[model samples]
Target: MRNLFPQRVLILFITVNTIFSLSGCVSHSKDNNDLLCVEKNVLNTANAEGSDALVLKNFEARPANGLLKEISVDLPAYESVVYFSTDHRDKILDAANRIFPWAAKDLQTIISKGFKPDPKAAEPSRNGLYVLFKLPNNEFLLLQGIASPDAMSHFTINDNGSLKIKLVTFGTETVSGDIPLVAYAKSDNLYDVFENAWKNAINTEALAGRTAMRHEKEYPEMFTYLGWCSWEQYRRKITSDLMVDAMQKIEESPLPVRWVLVDDGHQHQTGFKMGDSRMLSFDAHPETFPNGFKPLMDLRSEKIKWMGIWHAMNGQWQGLHPDHELRELDPHLIKIDKKFRGEPLPVMMPKGDSISSWMFYKGLIGSTKKHGFDFVKIDNQNRQMRFYKGKENPVKTVSQHAQSLERAAHELSGGLINCFCSDLLSLMNTKYSAVSRVSVDYLLNNMEKAKSHLFQSYQNTLWMGQAVWPDHDMFHSSDKFAGRMMAVSKAMSGAPIYLSDAPDHFLEELVTPLCYSDGKLLRPLAPAVPLPESAMISALTTPEAYRVVAPLPNGAAAFVAYNLAHPTPQQIVKTQISTQDYQHAGSFIQPAVPKWKVPEEGLVYYDWYDGKGGLLNDQYKIELDGFSDCFVQLSPVKKGWSVVGCIDKYLAAAAIDAIEYNQSELKLTMIEPGTLVVYNKKPVKCAMASKVEELGGGLWKIYFPKGKEKVDVTVTL
Candidate 1:
């Protein structure tokens, strides 16, 4: 609470009132005025007064004092706990957020009803990956666990206020040396603590060289173009003829769709059921395809630049069928070993060796390449743990599977879109993949679910965005419910912009603002992250707007505020935007260089949707209605002038191809013909512009006519 921790030492605290009573005494030191000791099993804080200590009970470290050292402390009382946990243990996929209030006086009631730890599990329970405790004085403590193939970590809060931490090896694999199990950090800023703990966990010796950081990875080429998917339009009923018709319609529409994703429904399966069926072969179903992927791929469309297909990470949701031809490639009938309707479930999977796994995936993806597909959307990738549970070491199995799939896809196709694969193991295994679906499938025509989808997508990006580009999934641009809000968010998300509109349902009005006429999207330079102050607050439970910020090219930043309050609160939710929000925007640029150098003169701020301008040194307040959003842009001023880029697009600054300014002149290069907005203290002359409209407050709008793709203009300052 008093910021007592040293600058470099990360602090994490835990308090426990064990059901199995253990004797512990509290002692104080007169010279230091701090709690010196708390008994045999208790670990005391060095620079704290009162009952501030951490308790460690039943401590056990693997390999007899390995990398993980023993921890013992009697933790002080906390105000509440914020954790991320999943209900499924055997096949841990996704985790959701939960918060529990704590009080020292209500220990009995809190232990009985507030928190309940699950029974001990043979395999590491999917209990939780991250935990945050709010101290009584408003400071925060964070704990982050590592999830890898060789080792897995998780924690649980006991009913008696005890915290149980588990770190174990997978299957029968043994560790000869040290491995990172957990990381800790403390900060008054929740965002700082969460990010620091994650960095520490991933930077450990076991994980450091295996994966690439988000900034180091390159987003797939399809991300720069506007795209469309067939999932929401045709689900599992998609056919060759249906897909051809959809492509024809897309080409005929005014909306410029550059890429097409044939999601799901096109796979060859043996059973009538969807999702539960097993793949019989890599060939397309004869009934639906009639020939193969040729008919759909041969569609004449110059606007469609790239096309891809979807399939599960495994051969299918239930893996390959027993009689599949590829079964000879070291196939194993994995007995799920879990009772389903009083019977053990069986799943077939390829052998987890490097050679066999690589060959299996190469065959499946090669078939797609032969048919002229450019990329793939691999789904359900988080089920690796269940398929190879006892057959091999989890670390090797998961790492091999990921490497095989990524290698095959990268070698044969453009890239892969990873879906349903945000689990800790899967996230850490993304060595070559670039894009990942961060949230569940997009809901249609449901307002409540739509709000939840948006909220989850932004919140999950706090961690998921660190490993790969976060795909918010696809949304229907024609829907009247939340189409505008989704479009605005996508423009700021720095992710691929794709739609799932059915035939003849494309809404040009809503889609036009997201990209140029050539289909290039107006995206931010980096993915949007939750505003630091709003990181700890749950948007769904609180009557407040969830805010996220992204840094744009040219030193501009965009902030989107979403009103996710349910039941439509009567009072308006307001948020403030200032220079503090974009102070770190320069760090997002590549090569460790700042694109838009901030001058001592400060910046010029403006609203994207509304034509409002002001000095960024003063905070700007935004008020929003229920389920709506407000997009604000901040541009730094240089030499008493600022280029606001294209005002027609949602991410206005993204439309500028290049900009250079000096004491007497400013040169601008535009990506497309639009109204270029700039702020200057004096009048300026532009020769290439068709006309110039001058607004008050040093604001000017320069109109460029539609002609060449790249328009260059010189303004005499």
Candidate 2:
């Protein structure tokens, strides 16, 4: 790699209380006004040969005025793509952000002269938690904020073509001493760059007490089975009678719904508006749920495995009500110096101390478990920073609250779904929770909204998948506009698959492709992520289909392409898929030898939606209409044979629980019964298959009896 650093460097110090700028090389200065100095020692470095090496230049700043507000860094502007948050909403929960490409020539102009806001603007700029730069030379750099005990950090583009790191603290709380404003890493791989930077950022002495949960931790059991949620079905108007009727319909329907989520409306709260309401008590609302969940809990059986309830992370949107019963447990009323709807706003929060916070969440979750709930979905977690902004230390307050909530939820219930918690501080404090909502609520009818939802869910998974199991939110299977698209997206997500359809409103055909009749989903080995070739391509601006892939069991891969053009593209968009897109599909598969060993015959390609089959040596072209999708499977051909898996399911290969290849026979174990398709150059015999048909060109169709689970069939070639 060409060295970008100089042998001898001269650092200039600037003394400014609010903002400081650095440009070009300058001689070393020793003036009294120069209170800020740059440390010459390199903290961390990654050395790789050729263009793959990502160098970290030595540059550490010591604040001039006891507290540092902002620092700017200048670097060579190249052709790059920037991924940043567009608003204040949590990146994962709200799904409101944009990724754009910048030409090498236009980078300087765009950075120096920021765009002017227009009332009719399609995309707006806002402060971002982290900014990722995809350099043209196959290298990536990620600059992210590290949450400290007293302050949080964000990034902005300065007018002088520099990247600025700004720190936010609780009211009057200063970030003094040697504080690392921003943590960064450079790598050829996107995942490596992000993980390295995030690890370096959070593993500091300042954030020593807080621990982040690993992505490989065991997620909630409900994620493996099909589920139903009450949010989109009944919204805030859900009642006990409605829930009972819904459950009765679910039990009778062919769609196997195992877990039930009792969403927001069941809680007792006080206020005129839903968004401004504060929770009143832990008990269910008397008017809505007269018996307080006993009738609902009675419906649980072998078929209905688990039940979960929803609550805000801070009790409710506006926090606890003035006369809430839990107030006696030592609640802290934080008065905001700001106004909401032209009125003074005050929020009641749990005490920041570990003991008090633990008691606060314990009271809420303990009562929930007592009422027969199996888990809790904590929403509005990102609002903790806003509620306690001026009251307590940002990191300490968020860590304590998150720990208390997760601890209580795990101990009392079995699991917790971290919801509306996409902020850095909240994400860092996620010590035990394994499941998190990765996108906004799935809406109905609107095709644009559906496309946006899919785009957000898939794109957010690029980073959010590193923290927790992504929950794409619930959808309605009965919607005529976007039902199939949503269903296919969920199947490809490798996350939990749930629906919010009203009673007797589901389409069995769409649901069957995702899970078995027993409610067990055929999930991929890992979460689906964007193909490396399509990583920087934005569907909003470009007329291209967004491609995502996930690893399936037994060395197979599932790839799905979505046409997410907004306002709907007029003409069909043609996209090409090749073996390159499916390379990472088997990265998560165990017994890794099956995936790494390339067969002499190459891989077999099967189209799930179109029902086509062939060798995957050449590129496959797909034409997608507006808001449509294309699903395909690629499995390696071994010993002149290939198992196409169960062709009935969307992610067909995931249905194979186990596969063993011997000298002349292949033993296959399946999770569900379906049409098993295999490719063999020689004749094959299978006794378990009721009938076998030879479709020309070495493709054979074997039929397995319906209603059989764990079907084992040996095919002798």
Backbone clash numbers for all candidates listed? 10, 0
Maximum-lDDT candidate: 1
Candidate 2 lDDT, tens digit per residue, 1-717?
A: 212221111123223233323333222222222212233211121221111111112323333322235555444344554544543222222322232222123223434334412111233344566666666677876666666555567665554545555655544343344343556666676555555565556555555445553443667787789999999878888899999989888888878899999998887887636456777888999998999999999888788889989988877777776667765664444433434688865556776778878888888899888898998888878766656555535555766788788788768888888787666666666667777777656788877667667766776666566566677888898888889888878877767788999958898888888888888888877778777656665565467888888888777888888877666779998986777666656543322223344456778878777777767765678899877888888887877678888887888887886787765888888777788888787888899888898865576888888865688879998
Look at candidate 1 and give me any clashing residue pairs: 43-72, 43-73, 53-74, 53-75, 54-73, 54-74, 54-75, 55-73, 55-74, 149-395
- Which candidate comes out best when scored by TM-score? 2
Give the per-residue lDDT digits (tens) of candidate 1, residues 1-717: 223222222222222333222344434332433332323433343333221212222322332211223234335576665555543332233231211111122223333532333211122223556666667676767666676446666555454656545554344444333345456666665555655566666665566655666777767887789999999867888899999999999988888899999888777877545435778788888889888888877874689878888888877777776666665554433334333357543556766677878888898799888878888988877766655554436556767787788889878878888887766777777777878888756767877767767776776776677677788889998767888888887776778888998959888888988998988888777788777546566565567777888888787888888887666677889887877777655433332343344557788888877786756766788898776888888887887778888887888887886788787888878888788888888887788888888866687888878643887778886
- Cα error, candidate 2, residue 397 (Å): 1.8
lDDT of 1: 0.67
Residues forming the 10-long window of minimal summed lDDT in candidate 1 = 96-105
The pairs that clash in candidate 2 are none
